[model samples]
Structures are given as structure tokens and as C-alpha cells.
Target: MADPIPETADTALVPTLLGDVIPRVESAYVLGLPSPQILDLVLERSRSTTVLVATDEEASQLKDELPDAVELVTAGIAAFAQDRRSQPRELVLALGGLDGLLPPADTMPWQQRLAHVTALAQAGGTVIVGLGNDAPLMALGHAERIDWARADDDPTRPTSAAALAQALAAAGQPVTTVHGLYGDPVNPGAAVIDALATGSRDGSLPAQVVEHVIDQAGTASIPAPDVVAVAARSGQLSNLATQWVAVSGGRGRSVYWTVDDAVVWADQDGPGLDWVIGGDADTAAALPQRVPDTITVERTLLRHIARADLPAFRAVARQLGDWVRSSADAAESSEIRLDEVRVAGATLARGISLRHAPVTDAAPVAEDAPDVEREPDPSARQVSASEARLAQAWRRFATRFAHSGRRSAWPAIFGEEDLVQLWLTMSGVAPGTVAPEADAPAVAVPAVVDEASRLDILQDRVAALTDTLAARDEQLLIREARIRTLRQQALGAARNRDRAVKLAQDLRRSRTYRLANQMRRASLVAQPKTLVRGVARKLDGKVRALRRTR
Candidate 1:
């Protein structure tokens, strides 16, 4: 098979930059190419295989550009979201056609479309969104912005890179500008080689100038990722939600979840330690004795363990325990810490007591994090009707609860007993009910149902039932006998009818009957009654004479 990733023009710079920062951020937006040229760049430079998601029109534009070896899925936002069966290593969302200027009738809102695309990013997959300058990128997420300034592509016009940087800075946003170099048309190989060697060749000078312009703009500031300010710890596990926020704390790092649910690897500059539960071969033996062999990570917008399995929860806690210990070991050296894990309403755990500072009052959570729960912002676009109904339901429920004069702000102020009771309720168990221990010896309790010992009575009832059935069977036999008698009578009638029909046919063919019919016809031939009578008498005499001769 042909190589999946074609080493084309020196498009490596953009892909290389994406490869470096995409793993670090929640999502990354490349604000340069109007097409999916950046996708090819990323694929050619990065070792990880990637796939492209595009609309029908976009896919049409991309026909024959990339080799058939690469997988491209053509689907709209909603269809793609519903049909995402597996996560690719990397995802490139071609959003050039989703220009902001287009009416909603023609195209979906770029913001919502972008949200869905970024939300599909796998735990380890890097999602690179390619869009034009008309669609703004800052409102999306903690997406690292890069300006690809193409040289000679449009030297006379203000390049998209320069214009985008100015727009972002005007909106008080930060952007990283990179010079995009293209190879010479005649000597493409030499030009690509030279540009790769020194960021730019002769044809790429315009891009270099655009980068300089962005630097001179003096408005854009490259700052660290901002940590969102969330409120204090909430009530019970049932009420409290796990939050995924874009913060300045963890850079060049992402918490990659393994496919086997074995570990959630936090890759960064730190001591190498695997936070593993059941799936890790080395630490499998060291796990808690009663840990489950497999774990189920909840499929929701929020990152949490949302299963009723206690053993799986313990296994998850063991992994989190490793993360906590690792965080504690490097607390002084590093800024990142694995704080309290917010369990789903279903996980069976109280709270983790950490030596370091307690988990931060989670900030107003960002809605862009994939594989985590995100509450929609009020200012954002309206969701589908079903989602709107759900939101309204929650609003109504919360409003009623608050108005009911109860002092409980469930999640924000849950007592230990309250949390336990809520967990029990969610688990379909009544409050104060003790769960039976499997290994414990069984004890005889007073029976609510009265015990009846009457084997003789049961025998008598069975005998009566048998007699009734036998009587029914006798009735059935009588019915069958009646049916047989009716059938015999019908057969006899059919035989008599057949014989009568045969006798009638034989009589009609007889010579005497034929002669009688001829005599009747000869009588009818006469005009008057007297003449007819005379002819009849003559015919009768002639018939008698003919009979005697025969």
C-alpha cells in the first residue's frame, strides 16, 4: 500500500507546532488555511495517524488531494456526533466552509459546530480545527491560536494571518503567529528543503513579513493559560458534578486515559509513575485484594466514575490513590496536584483526604472539554429541543426544591448522612436498610409469609385436578366421535349424489329417450291444433312400428 501520509511541501512547521501544543491544551485552533492543507501538514509531520471530518462540500473539495489510504468521513455536525463509534488518534475538523457570514439556513452556527467538533476529541487525540478568519476562535476554548502566513499566495492582499492577529488582539485575545512557507513551483523539492532548513526560503519572505507585523502589533500578549475561578465544594456526590476546566496550571500536559480503563496517564515533566488500577501488568498484583478486573468510565460530559459497582469504584480509587501519592511526592517541586476526585452519584466512595491543599473551589466550568460533563453557558446558542426540555426540567426541579423551604442546597451543603442517604436512594435501596454480606453465615429471620406444612392436602388437590382433567379429556373424545359421525354421513350423501348424476346422464343417452324427443319435435312442426294432433298420432304409430322393427 502507498504511504498514508505523503511528505509534501514543507508543511511540517504548522503540524509540528500543533503536535507540540495540541496534547497540552483542551483544544487548538489553527487560524490560517482556508482549506484542509494544515491537515496534510499535521499528518505528514506527526507520527500518529489522523482522520479528517468534513461536510459533503468540504469533502468534495478535498477529493484526490489526500491519498485513499487516509480515512475521511463526510458528515454534518449532528450526524457525526451521533455516529462517532471510535476515536481516532488525531482528528482534523475541516471548518473552512462554516464561515460566520453564512446564514443559519445555509450553514449551522460556527460556534456550535466548532463545539461539537472539539467535543469529539479522544482523550489522547489532538483535534485541529481549520477555519477561515471570518469565524472567531477565542470563544471556543483554551485553544492555542496559530496564524499561518502563506508567502506569495497573496502578497498584494493583507494575509489572513496578519488580519486575524489584529482582530484577536482587538478583542483582547492572544495569538501565536507562524510564517507559512510554500515550495517553489519549478524546483519544489529544493524549495521545500531550503524552507525546512531555514524556516523560510525566497518564496516564503511574505509570510516572514506577516509574522513580523504581528509581533510589531504590540497588542497581543502571549500569556499563560488562565485558570477559571469556580465556586467552593458542593454537597453530595449525587448533586455535585465533576468539572473540566482550561487552566494555566497544567501546560504541555494532558491527562490521557488508556483504552483499557487501566490508567489515566498525566504526561508532563515529573517523576515517571503510572496511575493504574486493574489493567496495569506491573501494578495489577499490588492492587487492592477485592478490586474489580475491569472498570467502566461514565460516558457523560463530566469526568466521573458513575457505576453502581463497588469493586470497580475501589479499583478506580486505588488508581486515584496513586495519582494522589505522586502529587504529594512532587508537591514541592511541581505546581500540578491531583486533588479530590468528584465522584458521580453512583460511585461508592466518601472523599479522599489529601495532604496537600484541598481541591480548588471548581471554577465556572468550560463546556469544551471532551469526555467530561459541561454545563452549557446561558449566552451560548440554544441546544436541541430535547436538551432544552432537560435543562428546563432541571431548572424547574431546582426552583421547586429551593422554594419548598428546605435548608438543603443539596450538593453545596450535603452532610455525611445526607450523602449516604442520597447514594442509597440512587442505588434503589431505602434509607437505613442494611445490605446483606455475601460471605456471612445465613441467619433465620421470622417469616412475614406464614409457613404451611400440608403435603397430604396438596396430594388431595392434585388428585382432584387430575380427575377434572380426565373428565375434560373424555368430553374431548365425545366431540371427536361426533365429528367422525358427521364426516361419515357427508361421505354417504356425496356418494348418492354422484350415482344419481351418472344415472341421469345414462338415461339421456338412451335410444328410446332420443326417439321420444324426435316425436315431440315433429308434433311441434304442425301449425293448427288438429293438424298437430293428427301429426302426433302419425308420429306415435311410426314410432311404435320403428320400435317393433328394432
Candidate 2:
């Protein structure tokens, strides 16, 4: 709410994530302190609204930001609930959840808070609650030491999605759908329903697609893709999600993913999943009309690697090569990355049709200017030409695979370059044609390793990279010294040249030199024949002198 953070591409994620589920109501009530952008979204969706914040400071801040039509309430949950006990709003949004809404000074029970929120919403009105998972998978990797002396302020707070959903249902507002939120809590990159996560199979398209979405939305510290892979295999992804959004009295889309700032959502109501993009109108318009294939070749390959299925991996690689050779043009082939290629039956399809054409802000063109066909920008063409060559793409994949901390089908001795060559050969590409750029020394990654060994591998890689950087730095220093010496020499030569020119100008400007030049000119004009004879005699004398010397 502090001057409303600048709207980014992902700014509309929360609103759009909840938009379909939120009923089109005339009035709404927002309890607790949600983001200003979210409030603005809520305001846009509803005609009239009321916002309640715990502190006077928050109320004062939001008062200037919210419109005049919106009624602002500043009080704790108990006070707000007592004041508005009789007035139940049509829609209630408590995205901040119970943590922020219940102040430490207030002794209100957790169940009572939930009851207050549900009571604030009229019967059949939507109540959306965004709750944090206290026992998320991240806790396993990054567990904080408990302070036994500290008081458990909110002991009854729901620890998991199920408990939160159960608590909400027990409060008379039965949850219709529970969405697992991933990435940033305030601005989640993905929102998937519990049903989809629970129903998806390990190698199915839905499972692959969900994993892909989770992969993109992973946290920095945890290897989310690997964690998700393990979790999905064990059928515990829903239970281990970072956060959950419990929706009561409304049904929402099954899956939501934020890609390039656009929101892609799909409902599991049809035979085939239909991904719909929702965001900037221009961006949505520019995207391919047809829905993208659910599963990506990268995801498929990753799954194969996870399961140590060498034959399947090789077959997919060959399929990808065939697709590149037969289906794609030269320009398109250069941009075909594994992640952007989709598995279409036995063949492969381009996952995103407009990878090269990024959505950009359209500047107004001059009306008077002629609509002439212009050549593509050479820089862009050069980039496209250099991007995603067969060897290069495979090399990138190999490097990722090496550092992925997942089990691989290849031998322990197989480094990134070895994997690259092997993959290229498997893909039916002539590895002999690959002129691989001189790369830093490869770190031999172990095929399988524990967390400690993985850390050791990472350290070894870092050490190798550091050595490479040091060598490059030494070369750079030598080049810099040579450049400095050349620059000094050039400057000295310029100064000498300036001095020589100055001296020449001084001689030319001297009175004696000027008088001599004028006298010579006058003599040549007055006695042209005499001057010519004298010049010939001088030349003859000079020739005799040169002949005598020789």
C-alpha cells in the first residue's frame, strides 16, 4: 500500500488468478491489509466496496489511494466484526489471511477470526482466503531453529492446505476449491487447484505440464524442479505446496501459470486442457490463437533422465532432430530450444509459435509516413542466427543436466561436452560438423549423489569457473597494459607532430622568410630569362658536385 509498487508484468497475476472464481458482485468487503494493486483489482471488479485495515496508518495510506466511493474502516478484527455484525457484504476477500488480520494485542481465537470473515460475507457470497503453509517442503531444506522461550501467539493457525480448507468449511463457508500458490506469496507465479495436483499421473501430460509450471515458479534456495519431481513421483505435491488459497462458494480454474508477464489458465472440464492467456489485450492478441501443447520436450527428457531411461531419452532426442530437420526452416531451427519444443504424438511441435516476437510497447507512428516494407534489424537477425544451434542447444541442456542434481542415464565420466556430442549423435546430427567454442574446463559430475556430494560437485564447478575467470583476467591485464602503452605512444606522436607543424608555421610567418619569398617572386616576374639561366647554372653546378663526390 506504500505508494502502490509499480505495476510489473506479474502485477496482475493475483487478480487474474482469482478473477474467474470471484463472482461479479455489486459490493465487496476486503478485510486485512492486501496489496494496493489487489485492492485496485477488487475495486475494478466490484462497483462499491469497503476496506478494513488493522492500523490507522494503513487506513490513512489506503484512504488516499482508494476512491471516494470505497468506505474505509480502521480497527482490529474484533472491533470490525462487532461493528459490522449485522452488515454482511456480498463478497469478502481476506488474501492477507489470519496472520496479519489478528493483531497480537487482540485475544480473538483463530476459529473466531475465520467465523468473522465468513460472517462478513453474505450466504452464497464468495470468500477467498490466502493462507500460508507452515509445513511446506521448503521447511525441510531451510528449517529455522525454534526459540522455545517464545510464546505461541497463534497456536491454532492451520499448518497445511487441508487444515485451512477444513477450518473454513467448519466455519459454515465450505471451500469449493483449494488453489496451491507457488513462488512469491504476494505475487505468486502459479496457482494450481488441489484436484489437478492430486489427480495427475507422473508421466502424463497434465502432470508434466503442472511440473513445468512449478519448475518456473520455484524458489531461489530450493531446487523446486527436483523437489517437485520427487514429490510428484510420491504423490505429495499438493501437500507440500508453499501456500494455498481456499475459495468458498465459487469454482475457479484448475491451473494458472504466469509466462512472460501473461497469465495462462486452464480449467479441467474438457477432454483436452485449453490454456487461455489473460493480461494485456495487445499481448493476448499477439499470442498464437491455438492453445500450446501441454507437454514440452524438455520436460519429457527431464522425466526420462530422472527415471534413468536411456532408450527413451535417445528416442526423444532423435525425434527432436527429425522435427528440426524436416519441420523447421533454417531461421526457425536456430531458435528451437528443448524447452520450447513440444511433444506432439510421435513427433515434436514448436511449443511457442512467437518466441522471437516478444510483446513490446507499440509507439505511435507518424500518420504522414509511408507504410514501406522495411528489412529486419540486422542485430536481431544476427541474434537469431546465433541462437539455439543443434550443438549449442544440446550443450546448454547437457550443462543444465549436469548441474540439475538429478540422476542421469549417462556414465559418471560424461561431462557436459561429452553429453552434448552424445546427444547430437543420438539426434542424428553429425557431431563432426560441430565447431564447439573453446569452453572452460568441464567439471566431471557424478551420476548420482547425496546433498553433500551435490554441494561438493557445485563447489568443484565454481572452482573451475574461478580458475577460468582468473586466466581470462590475466589475459585482460596484459591486453590493458599493451593498450595503455600504444595509447601513450600515439599521444606522444601527436604532440611531436603538433610541434613540427607549429615550427613550420613560425618559419613561414617570419618577416625574413616572407620578404625573401616576395623578392624571389618579384625577381622571377621582372627578369624571367635571367632567373631561368641562373637556375640552370645552379642545377649544373649541383650535378658536377654530385659527380665529383661519386
Candidate 3:
């Protein structure tokens, strides 16, 4: 089809850097589905104790149709983290076929399933692998033994993902335009699949750019591909998120992740429900609600001037200059005019003066970086001269061009354990041992038998089997029964383990609370009222003396 856009990680990691700006994605939904275990874990671990599971028709349909249970569980987690803004907990995805009835995978290949799961975990859900897997089948593109797996597309689902878009638009928040398949080659299928959409030849993302991005993501196996690289709207980059995830990998080049809207614009630290509505250092007196606490705008004043009238620009620039506390620049301040344009989310106005300086691109973390477990001086990485200049130009054209920063931060997401675990799950021996072009083995021909010879052979076999048939059938029944009993025992043990884990969590919480109470009681004492009374009398005497001296 359309040369199935390139599905490489590089293609996915191409962050839209317009004037040193990036995009963010926002999602809101009920999370943790179809499992009391997951709900319990989330409740036990998260800041919010109230856990919700959407027992709707859609979840059921998704479970039945989805090939991977891990995907479904991950989907639940992503929905909670993004839309629900719920604290994350581990959701174990029971291995495919190991469970009673594996979900039917009607379409989409195994590769897509694996990547989507990676995306979910990256978005902030804890995914874990469940037991009972076909290890050999995993080698042949079958997935089992998945851990910390979640799908990205479910959060950015096709029909249900318009809330963030509309909210942002209404609040005048920047938006990153994205499309399906062609949008992110490396992450072909994403959660925020708003629709089965298409891009135009004259769109912002040209066909060439799409090809470049896709190639960066990874190559798709298509025969006789005719690829055209030109400035045609290949598609918008929606559903920003981490493209590459692994439970295990030999130290190698960084992998890419598709961008998600909620994550794309997450604040430098991350999104949190508690954001100060006004009086924040973002330089905006009052930002619209669509802007989450975790996100930061490069220059709201520059963006406003670029999008509005010149007269309006004067007022906005005046306030911005005041906020920057630049007492040195405004004395010789002058208005700006646009010469050229760069567009991603906002239409920026450009001019050469003290008003705008080149924005800085955040320096890259050392390749094979591990995690952001600690806080640091929100440092922007060392950058190049050309990149700084480009960022300035993008800022000038703030209206048409918007930058989504989501793609810039994939590596920090979907930690090492999840990635290695998933890779282990989806990898092994290739599909079948029988080669595609292999021929059947030859067999020796049986000696020909006449009708009488056949009759004699059948009669002899029947006479011999008459006595043994019952015994043979009984033996077969016994074997079947024994195997069933063994299987039942194994399953029972697993269930028991699960129950034990649940009990352990409950006990842990209770003991923790109890210990905290004991410590507080022992470490603290009530103030003595008699001592307080003496201190008050002494204070009164001292005050009376001071008054008399005055």
C-alpha cells in the first residue's frame, strides 16, 4: 500500500524542532481494565487510592479482538496515566494462549503489537509479563512472556482522542498535526489513532519528510517499492510517544518512540494534576487550562505577537519585555516585521533586533542513558550554531509552526526492564522450522496387496485387537486424566502465588501504616500546660519591666 511508510526508530524520533520548540499530547480516560489484581496494585501503590475500571463494551471488544493480553493491560495503564492522571501500577499481561482463550488477532502483525506495548509502558504505565507462554512460538513471531507492556494507540485511539485536541485548540495551546501509518513509520500503529486519515501533497509534512522520518523509524519489508520524496503532506505527527523499548538489549544505538500529544507537551519534569492556574514563571500571567502543569512554552509573548495584529504585538511585547526584566533593551526598542516563515504549531513573527535570541536545543543525553531518577538543573544540552539560528526563525513564525517536544524524550521512558522483557517475549526461533520451499521427505512404497491379501490382513488385525482394544482405550483415558491433573495442579499453584502476592501487598500497607503511627507516638510528646503557664508568667514580668523602663 503507499509503500507502507518506513517503520524505523529514527523515523519515529525525528522531533519537530521549530524555533527550539516541541509539542505535547494530553489524554484523559478511565484506566486499569478487566483485572482486580491490577486495580489492587494501583490502589496499593498510587497516590490516588480510588481505582476505576471501565467495564464497557469497547473493552470487551478490544480484549476479544486484540491478539495480545499484555497489550490490553498496558492499554488500561496508559489510559489511566494520560487521561485519568492516575498513579501507575504494574498490570501483568497474561501470556497469549497460556490463558484460557487468547484474543483473536484479526489484523495487524506481531511486530506492531510488540511496539505498541512498548509505547504504553513508555507513557507511564507499569506492564509486567504473566506466566504460561509458548517460548518456541515466540521465536516464530508469537508473543508471550510479556512484562511492562502496553500499547500506545489505545491512548491515542482513533475516535475517542478528540478531547485533548479540542481542549488545546480552545485554550490556544499548540497542537502537533499527525496522521496514521505514514505519520510515524517506526510507530506505524499508535494509541491516539484519531481516525483513518490521509495527508495532502501540499501539506506541511511533505512526502519526502515522511519518507525520511519513516526510514529513521525503520524500514518496512515491501517489494518493488516506489518511494517519492517531495514536499507533500505525508501526514501529521500525532500520538507522540517513545518508539523504542526493550526488556533486554545489548548496549546499542538509541531506539525511537512515537510521540503522544499528552506526553509531547508534558512540562520539563512531567505532567501533574496540581498546576498553579496563575502566577507561574512560564511568563504568562494566566495560561489557559489546556496547558498542563508539566508543560512549558518557549515564549508566549513572541507567539502572541506573531499570531496577532501589529498593534496587539506592541502591547504583548511591552508586557513580555517587562516580565523578562530587561531594563536594558526596551529603551531602544522597536517593532519587528516578518521576512521569512517556519511553521509547526504557531505562526511566529520575525525581525532582527534585541527582541529575540536563538532558542537553545536541549543537549542530548549520553547514548545508552539509563533513567532520570533524580532532579537536576533543568539543563539544556550543548547545541550547535545552526540549530540555534533555526530555533529563532521558528519562534518568529509562531502561528503556523508549532514544535512538539514529545519525540525528543523517548529514551528516558519505557525503562530497561520492559524493553528487554518484551524483546525476549516476541523473539526466538523464526516462525516455522519447515522451510518455505522445503520438499516433503520421500517414503518407501508399500508392497501391493491383492483383495484377498487385504482382507486377510484386516481380519488378522481385528482378531488381535478384540482383547486389547478395551485395555488400550483405558490406558489412553488414564494418561489423559493424569495430564489433566498435572495441569490443574500447576495452574492452582500459580493462582495461589497470585493470591499470596495480593495478601502481601495488603499486609505491607497495614504494617507500614502501623509502624509510622508507632514512630510518631514515640518520637513526639505533648507540651506541658504547667510549663507553658510558667513561661507565660515570666514573659508577662519581662514585658512589664520593659514597659516600665520605656
Give per-residue CA lDDT, model 3, range 4-42, as digits (tens).
112222221222111011112121111233233323233
Q: What's the true lDDT of residue 210 in model 1?
A: 22
- How would you order the candidates by lDDT, starting with the best? 2, 1, 3
Give each model's whole-structure lDDT. 0.34, 0.68, 0.30
Candidate 1 lowest-lDDT run of ten: 223-232
Cα lDDT of model 1 by residue, 294-392, tens digit: 111211101232223445434543443333334332232122212222223333111111122333322244467457466855555533332222222
Could you say which candidate leads in TM-score?
A: 2
Q: lDDT for model 1, on a 0 to 1 scale?
A: 0.34
Better of 1 and 2 by lDDT: 2
Q: Would you list the rank order by TM-score, best first? A: 2, 1, 3
For all predictions, the C-alpha RMSD in Å is: 27.7, 28.9, 38.6
Estimated TM-score per prediction?
0.22, 0.64, 0.20
Off by over 4 Å in 1: 1-13, 22-37, 44-57, 85-105, 130-211, 214-550
Error of 2 at 25 (Å): 2.2
